[model samples]
Target: MVNSSALSGNDTESRETLYQSKFVYIAGIAEMIVVILLILCFCIFVCFNALILNVYFTTPHVHEHARYVLFVHMLITDILYLIASISLFLVAIYAVYIPMPICYPMLNLAALTFRITACNLAIMALERYVAICYPLQYFQFCNAHRANTSIILMWVVGAVPNVADFFAMQSTVEQDFFSRNVICDLSLLAVNPLQNTIRTLTFISTFTLVALTIVFTYIKVMQVAKKAGSGTSSASKAGRTVMMHALQLLLCMTAFISTVSETYLRDSPVMLLITNFLVFTCLPRFLSPVIYGVRDEVFHKYIRTFCLFNL
Candidate 1:
């Protein structure tokens, strides 16, 4: 009654304070729900990977084939990739400052496994191409012994850019670089002009070669399928397999490019989490079990028992 303006000001301030608090409370709950969902999905993938791997190991007929061996190798590489990626995510979310020495290995492992995963898809396509197009030479060209050797070569091929980036960072920074503690991030490794340039150039060159290899394999396989003159021939199926691999490679490339997209998304934690985790990183790995593991008649037959028992 005495001063209506002052009373209105107090009421407005109280409402604004309450609104701010409610907004924060809602944001916290939403972030927690997202994290829980992420963890649940991750665990499910791990279990599925384990079940498939167990079946592969326990069944001699399945594990003895060159194609199955290659499949197993891909799964193992993916598991490594998933573990490394999730570890990085957890640390980032918790704001844990890990020492450089410890963090470097984890970061590089993530990078290395990512490269290996892409290479694995390319090699697997080539394996199918050889099996279908040149059946007579399949045993010689893509046998289990050769499959194991290819896995080793994949790691070596993947390590080149990582080693180069490390040396480049070393050249630019002081010797005490390893003594400090910082958040484990890919951007941290690319902190210098030289490192960023190398990263960009390497990304362009390496992925170009990978894409070309996948495209070449897919085309060759398709040509062989057409010449076979039968819709149900192994060549046709192999052609489809190569196409599937191309899709998986596309997913992997999407994850790599997320680092580039982070600039626009840095301010929004929710956006970054969704884009990086759901769309790019985990989507490909999650689809692997569905696309290949469940769809393969042989694999499906073997895992049916395990699924029924576990269900």
Candidate 2:
């Protein structure tokens, strides 16, 4: 009876070991696939943004307009965000946690880029509203100089919360070499009560205001479009473009929620967290060039000419 029991215990242990190995193998494959996808996204973002920047700069008509000015700034922010995402991906691939000295700044910059992108989208929506609803006032309201000033102000406002986050991380979080790399994870760092409160309030208030403004502006624009019978087709096209921007904003907001939640949900599956992160980081960036640049008639003409000449 004792010999039989010993043999059964040995068999159970062997099965457990085999199961662990198999799980690890599957996880390794998943990570590899994710890494490859991230690399592809990085390439696409860089190439498409570069093309857009080139066309906008080379074409006087496109660059001189206030709307394109805002679009250019949006592209810049997307590039910055992509850089941060690439950095995070590298850390993940290496499986080594970077020290606080490097991690804090990286996370802060990512936050800044995020804030700027949100501001840019809101500005774009406002520009579209004015153009569609109040065509005469559009010129007075959204001049090139004014657009430049707005972008400068956006950078200033975006930096404030991130600067606070940097200080908060410095004060509350100690350098821990043993900790796993949580690259670009602002919530992972230790933050004091005051800093946490400020961060939360700032994030919620800014996003809420921006979102409400976008929604209201777009609704008004659509109403105006509906009333303009002869111009309905052009107005409808512009509405679709605005809708694309709205979808991008929605994706970004969802990404923010997923990122924050993933930090605290320790029991959540790893694959799900990775999928959410990838979708949030890559999808919006990918869509920006497509929705804003490729869809533009001028950009399409330039791209086709360039391609034909090259061929």
Candidate 3:
């Protein structure tokens, strides 16, 4: 009886081990697949943005002083965002393929790129706000030199948090776990309350500023349309375009907000899928093109050309 009982216990242990092995294998494969898909989608977006910019810049009629400058600004920001997405895709791949104790600097590069791109998005929003709300003053407000300075300043400001994150990382001891491949989260760092407070405040400020900009632009646009006498029809068309762009920006903002909110909820399989889908898969790949393509004259022209040629 004792021998039979011992054999049964051994069989249970073996089964548990086999089950865990299978689980890990499945998880790793899924992570790899997702990362590959993300990289491919990001490349596609980069190509589309590049093509649009090229057409806008190369074409004579579209290269007016104001339109040209706006196109250039859009191109710069889109490139930054695309580069940041590539960093994220690479990091996701590393998290799956590599073991713990990753090359710290590379992770820092990814974080820096992402931070800068976030700032760039906010600045881009502000640019659109200026164009829509103060169209008469836009050429004066965002001249070539001023626009360059603003973009440069945004890069510097974005880097400050990344530098703080790097030093914070050195102070904390890194850990290894079996489930996810080589996770490196700054949230796991043992940081001071002040650091946490600053980070939280920064995020709140950014979110608030973007929300205000969008709202103010929309309101100003409506008011301008109401006051215009003979120009009401033209103003209405411009307002519609601005509104469409704002709506797309709002969608991106909402996705990020949803992801943040989901983090507070207890982690479950369903919640994980939903949050990841919004932040990683859906928002980046789909929304950007739909919004930009609709508003972008160059993109529309090229798309029309392509369709005509194909047909």
**Which candidate leads in lDDT?**
1
Model 3: CA > 4 A from native: 1-33, 60-138, 163-183, 188-190, 229-232, 254-282
Residue 198 in model 2: lDDT: 70
**lDDT-based ranking:** 1, 2, 3
**Which digits, one per residue and each the tens of the lDDT, describe model 3 over residues 41-139?**
656667666666777678776655443454456455545544544454344424545433453444445444444444444555556557656779987
TM-score of 1: 0.93
List where candidate 1 sits over 4 angstroms from the true fold.
1-4, 269-272
Instruction: Write model 1 residue lDDT over 144-168, tens digit each, in one string.
Output: 7898899899888789888988888
Model 2, 1-311: lDDT tens per residue?
99999999999999999999999899879977877787787787788778788988888877778989998898888788777766864675355567656776666677788878888888988888888887889889988899999999999988888777667656766666325455434545646776777777887987888888788877887787787765646566667767877877886676576566666654665566566667776776777677767678888787778778986
Model 2 ranges off by over 4 Å: 1-12, 89-95, 166-184, 231-234, 304-311
- What is the lDDT of every predicted structure here? 0.82, 0.76, 0.57
Error of 3 at 241 (Å): 3.8
- Model 3: what TM-score? 0.67
List the lowest-lDDT window of 10 residues for candidate 1: 270-279
| TM-scores for candidates 1 onward, in order | 0.93, 0.83, 0.67
TM-score ranking of the models: 1, 2, 3
Candidate with better lDDT, 2 vs 3: 2
